[model samples]
Target chain A: MRRILRKHAIVEDDWTLDDAARTPAGLIVPLARWRAERELLLASAAAIGVLLPNTEDVEAIYPQIADRPLIALQFPTFTDGRALTQAVLLRNRLGFAGELRALGDVVRDLVFWLGRCGFDAIVPRPDQDLEACRGALDELSVAYQPAADAHAAVWARRRMRASA
Target chain B: MYRYDEIDRELLKQRTAQFRDQTRRFLAGELSEEDFRQLRLRNGLYQQRHAPMLRISVPYGLLNSAQLRRMAHVVRKYDKGYGHFTTRQNIQLNWPQLAEVPDLLAELAEVQLHGIQACGNDTRNITCDYLAGVAGDELVDPRPYCELLRQFIALHPEFYWLPRKFKFGFTGATIDRAATRTNDAAVHVLRRDGAVGYRFFVGGGLGRLPLLGQEMNAFVPEADLLLYACAILRTFNRFGRRDNIHKARIKIVLREWGVERFRAAIEEEYAKIGASAEGGQLKLLPEDIGRMRGHFDAPPYRPAGEAAADLRAQAASDPRFAAWLKRNVRPHKSAGYRVVFVSLKAPEQAPGDCTAGQFEALAELCDAYSFGELRSTYDQNLVLADVAERDLYALWGRLDAVKLATPNIGLTTDIIACPGLDFCGLANAGTIGVTHDIYRRFDSLEAQYEVGPIRITMSGCMNGCGHHSVGHIGILGVDKHGEEWYQVTLGGSAGNDAAIGERVGRALSRSEIAGGVERLIRAYLELRSDEEETFIECYRRVGMEPFKARLYEAEGESGKPVPSESEERPPGESGQGARAGMARRGVAAA
Candidate 1:
């Protein structure tokens, strides 16, 4: 019964999680189900969400995820960090502007980099502190490289100030 | 030294606060031990055999006197009275309490120093030639780029958790003193057609799988430097092995994919990043580069005022001073200044271990003679980077009082040993004891100077924290049946002539290790072409056959030599200026 945090707030998740149920309202399907039921999904569902495992060949589903409302990347382990690149490529390469949600192994500690890498909402595990996860955003005042948050890098800001 | 801008300071402050919060959570049982381990290690905290070891960043080995005093203050207030300087140009306080680390980090931040990315599976430190600015042979000073890149990689969001520890070595000198061939990604800066650029090498590492990083790009323009580095790291993050911790280094990825395929993948990743706005953000702005370049205005050097005759006469009168001058003194870019090296290896003392008293003394010497600054060498020594020629006689007096004048910078007694079983939880055998035994055997100043330029390094285990795999005479300690044993490797090097040493024979017991090392040395002394030919040069010319013949002239199986580790790809066949797949590209090793 763990809920999802979207755009900095908790939201009720009503999407169907498995392929056994075909929901007309919202369909959040795994990688296999989405690959097999692509036509049925786009034609029927109001919103489409695709779940990608850490090992999923994301380029295969890149074209289909453009108009999708959500993309949930599962982390087999918190420290694996494979999904971070997926999220980066999704935003930078595939141009997926929808909500990138981190699904499994989502803990409070990873919320900061998760947001930086384009995950807007982290669907944390049951025991995580939902309120404490919000504090991760404020952890670092500035970033060095360009990430999904798209905040100006510290060096760029310094250059601007120096020029002025 | 790059000064921190407002944004840089702000980021570090916020980073400290973030770590403080993380520490509070871990102590409160909110974060699991396994989860907090990565977080703490990224901040340079390692739970060692005795207590938590905190390593602070010394970017490119440059530090001012004020930072040294603050380090002394922390050492005095914290658990231990001593600290260890690592081969990667970072200072490690071995016994810091886990709870007080947050406060220590804050104090360190006040001096423009912190442990961010100092350890863990991330960019540890951006080390460079310690004599970058001062070396007369250097083409360009690499500190400005090193400083900029150090800040850029500090707590980089995407690179926070690397597959394995990443290291960068930058050198603008022809000498390759920074060991560029042994780091994860190394950049050698060169000026061509009046334009400055870098040659990039990737996947070089030393731990279990030693490799000389192959060249990825022949030339990356100054504007595209950071982007190129980012691309390599991104590709490594995506494709590096996560199944096995030991095989997770970027070198393994390069080996598995082969050099050409890995190079193509990095170039493709770079192209993707360049086509994106994120890559555009990675550009080093013109104004930013100019500002960084302005920080390194050289110190006002006096004219060449000291007489060489006076120094030579003094050396002739005093043999001790002559030995010190030969080993400890190096030429400086400024004619009158001598880059005086202070050796940390004394008779029985562990290499690179500096007590609080030594730190304070060195700080005073640095303030008086070195324009209040000091640089740490990868050879586990300190350099007063701006000592005047006239001040050496007086400086020797102060150094002599503190036993800092060991007169062995790269000699046999100046051995590099890791904090092996004595302090490291990962270690199987003791390294300091072996170092002590070797130092005691080769204690004579005259004999060591006679056997010139012999680099012997030892490590506790296969992790190679001591960089024993690349030592000219590498000794790796192994555990056999719950007993300590040591293996000897000959002719390993990290320089213009970089190669992984080959194992000589079978492992020796603790009692016979020193004698085994002496036997190899005796063989080198006997077989060397002349006095000028170093141990490595002689060893290289003779290959392993003569050394093997001498080593097993008595003890090996049936009084016959054992098969060597490098029989398949001997010395000249494989490692002469050849790395991975890059064969004498636009730039060649010196």
Candidate 2:
């Protein structure tokens, strides 16, 4: 069982990514598999999730967001940051309100950026300390740019304060 | 210059602390080397050949006297007694210790300076025309927009990592003094119809394949500039190639997809970003623009037109001052004021290096003369952007005492050379030795003046940081079986008419480069239609055959190897310098 940092807390992950699970319930299948068995999986789903590769266009899943419980965007490697854009597009553009998870090559150092890009759940690499990752999330309270995060950009805040 | 408010200071404090922790983790072996490199590079730390080099971002190349004093103090107290001003308008300290970098960054932050995004895959420290607000032919002042863009890109979460490093250059004047066409993106401020807007050129770069930017958008309204930039960035982040480092820059992406397809993708992304609630908030409100403009308001200028008679008298008394006045000064936007270029291309020193003592003196001079402000040009020189005509003599006297007043700006002796093999870890050959040899050949100011205005840019390696591709005379160093060789290119220009220089002939040996350059200049002098016809113009008119003939024919007369087709550059050793051999060459050079 793997523990993931979900919304700033390290908790045991209930969602399994194994394709050949004895029961398809709570199984997060790859994008291709989910697309192939879409009708079958939608009927008896106990909480279906889709493991979307970073390369997959988020536009394809815009209509499917309402049904999916989770969408895990793959990082492949920490430096390969195409997933950051995917996560942003999913949360900000497609309006996916479900659990937007980040998987693969996740480190405590990258926890802040992952959260800012709307990754609620992060599967940190085995060596990363969960406590350190939790602390890293709040390392920078000020952001200069607007992202999918809840905080307003500093300029906007400044404008509001000045008007007030 | 934009001063940091409490929010900006807090952000910098937090970012510095984060780097401190990352350094601790790396030192403690908690972070892997490859992982630590990604973290450190964002904070402007690089592991060079001799020591860790820290590049401090002087946003838009604007700095106050106090900030310069702090830089002087930091350089003197840190590993080195000097620093190098890069062509991108950032200052690089080459010998800082890795463990002490966090403290160095902290000191810099006290003066509202930080290394954030200075040399990373993120939007790099923005470069702008050194004469942004002061140039006489200016349209809209670009400093405020540059500041806004600088803040928006600093530590942006989504763009923290991309396929490759990105750069930006901005210009507000009629002339492109910032070399905007050679950057990742160029933002030109202009007025269309009745309102101010920006013309964006994207996919420009100077690397393995040098390419100028294409006009991505003709007119982006002032309010939507940042949003448009975000769209461009998001598209690049999503689609830029990661498999090959050489093919990862936006230029390659734009080339592969074609400008039309790339423009379509950016436009689509722009529409989506503008529609999104989160991104709509990122729009530049009029209030926000006003706030930025307030910071960069012009300094209080006083008219001194009456000083013209005194200036003429001084010039008449001293021919040296007259030559300097002709070469090193430019007409200011304000009446009775001038823009003074303090040349760092002294023959005895490295092209862009300034010692700690010189920095301190320059700081004092800034307080006395240019409204306590200084700007670093992309040509690796400093500028006193708002000096009064009455104070010219006094300022020149102080500058001359410090050996900072070289009167060869854009002339033959005013060469731009990178640190090459001596300092840069990536250089294949030495640049300073050959630069000194050329300086000795053109030793006198009179001799240099004979050649007229020509840009001779040299790079140690093919990374093109010296901007060799755009120089009127480009010198590229290549490694030949443990020996150093130089390749020459002619007729490159980096202004509004940007073009990549064409190769002249085969590579010149280390012993042959200086004389070869002299012969090329001699050919230009002899072949020019008139003295008024500049080197680039004459070269353009006469073409390369005559110059190539002069170089090779002269080489044959000297009993050296003559240029020939059989001696062409190796399959992989073209001036682009294949990226495959980078790692091996780096290790071998070290």
Quantify all predictions' global Cα lDDT against the true fold: 0.81, 0.85
Q: Which regions in candidate 1 have their CA more than 4 angstroms from the true location?
A: A22-24, A57-60, B306-309, B553-590
DockQ of 1: 0.65
Count clashing residue pairs per candidate. 0, 0
lDDT of 2 by residue, B101-214 (tens): 999999998999888887768889999999988888899999999988887888888999998999989998899999999999999999998898999999999866889999
Chain A structural similarity (TM-score) per candidate? 0.88, 0.92
Q: Which model scores highest in DockQ? A: 2
Give per-residue CA lDDT, model 1, range B1-590, as digits (tens).
66776777887898898899899989999889988998898898988766898988898998888888888889988857888988898899888889999999999898888898887888778989988888877877788788778767777767776677889999998898888889999999878787778889998988778889899998888777788888888888888888888899999999999999999999988887788877888888667777887887777666777512266877898888888988999888777778899999998898998888888888899898888888898878888988888888888889988999999998999898887766666776778888998888899987898788888998877788788988999998776544566788898998889999998877776777887788888899999998888999999999998887776555743443334433222111222212311221222222
Runs with alpha carbons beyond 4 Å of true place in candidate 2: A43-45, B305-309, B556-590
Per-residue lDDT value at B344 in model 2: 93
Candidate 2: docking tier: high
Q: How many angstroms is residue B445 displaced in model 2 relative to the true structure, after the best TM-score fit?
A: 1.2
Residue B175, candidate 2: Cα error in Å is: 0.6
